[model samples]
Target: MHEQDFEVDYLIMGAGACGMAFADSLVTNSKSTLAIVDRQHRPGGHWNSAYPFVRLHQPSAFYGVNSRALGSTLATRQG
Candidate 1:
């Protein structure tokens, strides 16, 4: 296998919710470069591995990146 080097101000260990949120905050507040590493093929961490019947312990609005809303505003307004 080939090895490579990377230059970044922040090296995030996972691509999970927290990691993604932190990355988003850094990107919005600074000009620092970042690298996110994850063992899984996708983001969302445990959320990806959870059973389909499983649900979030908290409201969906309480989750997700701070810069963006988790659900549609129109849907909330309608309901």
Candidate 2:
């Protein structure tokens, strides 16, 4: 891999749901700069592979970072 110097207060890998949320909290709560790198063409991890109208098996509040709310627009997994 090529070597490069990254200057930032925080460096996060993977723009997966958790990573994105953590980065958001850091940026929102502090004056620090951040850099995010992900191999996926898009963010959201496996959610990208899932169809819409799908809700998390568990409560949305239980999924994301504690610093933020994932919203209460909960969906049922049962048909």
Candidate 3:
């Protein structure tokens, strides 16, 4: 196998909601480089494997990274 090297200030183990959120916060608050690693083909952790019909148990606003909203504000407002 070919050898590779990476240099980063932070190495996150997962690319799930929490991990992504943490990365977002770190990026917004600091100038550190980050490397996010995940086993799945995409991010979102378990959500990626969940059924398409599955829904969030709480408001969408409460489910994603701090810098962005998950869904329409009207949906959260109605709940």
Off by over 4 Å in 2: 1-6, 50-79
Please write out the lDDT profile of model 3 over residues 1-79, one tens digit for every residue: 9989989999999998889999999998899999999999887778878844664667676775655567675344332
> In candidate 2, what are the lDDT values of residues 1-79, reduced to their tens digit?
9999879988899888778888988887898999998887877777767744554566666665645555487433544
lDDT of each: 0.79, 0.74, 0.80
Per residue, candidate 1 scores C-alpha lDDT tens digits across 25-72 of 999889999999999997777787885455566776777565666755
Instruction: Estimate the lDDT of model 2.
Output: 0.74
Q: Which stretches of candidate 1 lie over 4 Å from their true place?
A: 52-58, 71-79
Query: How well does model 3 score by local distance difference test?
Result: 0.80
TM-score to true structure, per model: 0.71, 0.58, 0.70
Residue 40 in candidate 1, Cα distance off native in Å: 0.8
TM-score of 3: 0.70
How many times do residue backbones clash in model 1?
0
Clashes of 3: 0
Task: Give the distance in Å from residue 4's predicted Cα in candidate 2 to where it truly belongs.
Answer: 8.7
